[model samples]
Target: MLSICLIFFYILLIISLTLFYFSMFFMFNDLVLFIEWDLVSLNSSSLVMTILLDWMSLLFMSFVLFISCMVILYSDEYMYGDLYMNRFIMLVLMFVLSMMLLIISPNLISILLGWDGLGLVSYCLVIYYQNVKSYNAGMLTALSNRIGDVALLMAIAWMLNYGSWNYVFYLESMKGHFEMQFISWMIVLAAMTKSAQIPFSSWLPAAMAAPTPVSALVHSSTLVTAGVYLLIRFNNLFINTNLSKLLLLFSVLTMFMAGLGANFEYDLKKIIALSTLSQLGLMMSILSLGYPNLAFFHLLTHALFKALLFMCAGSIIHNMKNNQDIRGMGAITLSMPLTTSCMNVANLALCGMPFLAGFYSKDLILEMISLDFLNILIYFLYFLSTGLTVCYTFRLIYFSMSGLSNSMSLNSISDEYYIMLKGMMGLLFLAIMGGSMLSWLIMVTPMMICLPFYMKMMALLVSIIGGYMGYEIFKYKLSWELFLLKNYFLSNFIGSMWFMPYLSTVGMNYYILNMSYKIIKTIDQGWNEYFGGQSIFYYSKNISLLNQMIQNNDLKVHFYLFVIFIILILMLMLI
Candidate 1:
């Protein structure tokens, strides 16, 4: 069955890659493939299934298919000898299908099919381990995502007022319609949850409880990108809008928060996961600033490199017998030189190193942001996040790939990892080359580039400083880290995601849990015990005792009854 799935992925990959060039030549304009159902109309609105095969969707689909195929192949080795390998593979395939569905559908109703499918299938994959941690993470992932699903549903309902469920028709034309403007906000909110923007970000890191392959695919490419893609498609509606301003605010915060969290995080997968969060923030913040194309460019490039990053992490984790903490890992480059080199490439790309895939989109986004109207705080955060990205990544490298050799001997290491290595090779190439190719293909109307030298080199400068800091902190054992010792609470606060997992999980449910406690106290314990069975039993027992006394025909009972009757007669006479 795994073999069959791999064959299917390979065929789809071939088909999508073929369409890549064809889509560029042919789909210069938006082409909607409509499968209309004239027989079904509601409130004079036409019901149709629509697929929009523009360059954007086609290119994104091709990339998704390519990465997904690699992920499937990687899973073959990572999941070797598992009891439910077939189930895992099918779930991944279904996940890819859902992503494809999401990519093609322009009609809101059609989108719901794919949107809901992505959420449901992701839940299954997150809980694949069938353990407590996996279960909790799955719930967080599903429920956080369900917010977007519900938001989309509401957006779909709102579009009914416009007499059509096809949102593609309304993107540009409906901007002047003040009443219809709320729909754009709804869509942004929906995008926020799906993209794991601030207040909705707890799930992304927690979701690392899933297998590394799922983490690579879902976190890097498909599931989280769904929201960003939706926003990219809906960019026309957000231009010059206040909602876009709000989106910019949240996305920047999210980027900074995730970068900050990554520096503090210890888990190897979580460091990558938080980095993914930070990149999503970068994408979201850029889209919020009205550069949807740049966001899309970054999104694609990010997918390529981030997927490679996760795959490298998986290779290391698998070889280390599942030890994921950086403290437990060292000298990975010694044992797995190929994997280490690939990991370094992916990390360098993420840092927007010269001419790499991430550099293309990331540099463009940062440059554009500098050109845009901005204040000090937002501007500072933008650069700070770039630095912190490098900070955490170099920190990761220093801990895992360099320093003291803590790993087992390097013998037989290269031979044992051929399958996983093969899978990563394809992604590694794309991570290196996909940026420049996609940049040329997608960005036809390039920005007018002009910047002072210091401004232009801002990203690079920060990256250099961040790298030095990471190396020094690990090498010298920084003083502030020890200051955290004096302030253990503060250390844990930042280290524990500012307690977001606690807050998102426990704080979100605080009110409902208290209400439940009240309900139990009032109904189940107090009212139920007194009135349901206890009261009835008490009265019945007393009556039975009275009956027993009467049936006994005791002399004392008769005397008391006669005395009570005489007293009543005397009282009546006195009245």
Candidate 2:
């Protein structure tokens, strides 16, 4: 008997494969089709529903569908027997629908519908656990995304100058138009927040409070990549402008920060989440460098492995009775060979190992940057980030796969969940082969590379050193003189993601929260109590009591009031 999840999975898989072939055909033929429906018109403005069919959008749609189908299939086993399994499946489907909508729509209004849909569904998914932690993470995720929503809205408003909301039609003509650059700024701001770049990055790791399938699908692929996808479409706005330079600076910083933070992270899901952030930064940086095709290629490949990585992490977490700490998960390979193998492949691919999915895109991006006339800082950060990526990935592998079992003896960890393994296996093949496949199809004209021997070898040299350092660092971590004990502040700073979580949460909220507390105390509880509701209640009660006494014929009070009034009137007459 087939379950609901299986039903959706089979249906979506067929659709994904169909779309994939169609996208290839369209790419080969250089075809584009637009279907627009004008719903309303008011003087100079119109409401339209636009559907764009191009190779890029179709290819992305196919990948999203494939990943969604796999995740939904995996969730069937991962979330088995839960009371709200149906609701979980529904949310995931809605998220897929939202991502598809985002991919197909070239109009700003249509994009916002998809953008806000992703944000809203992600928040729902994040808080799905119904715990305090989930609630906080959900709030952070939602609020951070709301900033981008606002920027998109502002962009929509500014688009009134063009008398059209379809940014697709305007990209070529709007170049070098200083008066309209505000729209580009708004678009970039919106993209930054959506993609979790730098200041907006704290939410990506925090969002690991969501279910693992959600982490796999939303954080790793669809939701976070929406911003990068949008930027790819808007790449024209960046040509011959300093906007790309500014974006490159911030994005490279995001890459370095996330890579550095992941090395210190212990939680299995969060390390992956931070890694997703680093990859998003890499995508953004390359996009800023004016290689939307390279960024898009990497995006597709990263989606494959990152989703698989999360699936493996989810399996481990589920089997470990929800324990996510890597320190407690050594020698996992002995029990779950398939899961460990899949995870290792994903990690190695992330490190840009030869011929893997990450290699074709990541290496090309690095090589292109080497050839470009970039400043020293950009080059330094890019290479440093590349090394840090390897360092953290190796550290993760060591802690989780290569040590003595820290778990209790009774642990039943194994790769017996065939349904989960099936989902992972599907992506495993792609994680191995997707890079070469995508590069051949997407890069119609192969890039010719010219670089110094040392520069050409820089990525490999850095990886070798970073791997050795990772092993040494692992041994150091287990030493009697733990680095955390001797240099608590430095370790804490790095581990805590440069206090970004603090700044994003308490630091940003403390003053406002304090002011709100004071207002509550002084107004609602203090002055308002005395002069507003409390005073009104008290005076009304006293007046009612006096009326009751008068009605009860209490002559003493009435006679005294009457005598005082008469004396005052008599004195006034005499004056």
Task: Give me the runs in candidate 1 sitting further than 4 Å from their true place.
Answer: 27-47, 408-412, 478-481, 522-524, 527-563, 568-575
Of the candidates shown, which would achieve the greatest TM-score relative to the real structure? 1
Off by over 4 Å in 2: 38-47, 516-575
Clashing pairs for predicted structure model 2, backbone only: none
On residues 238-258, what C-alpha lDDT tens digit does candidate 2 reach at each position? 855788888988999999999
lDDT of each: 0.86, 0.91
lDDT of 1: 0.86
Candidate 1, 73-144: lDDT as tens digits: 888888988989888888988898898998888777778889899999999988998999999999999999
Error of 2 at 509 (Å): 2.0
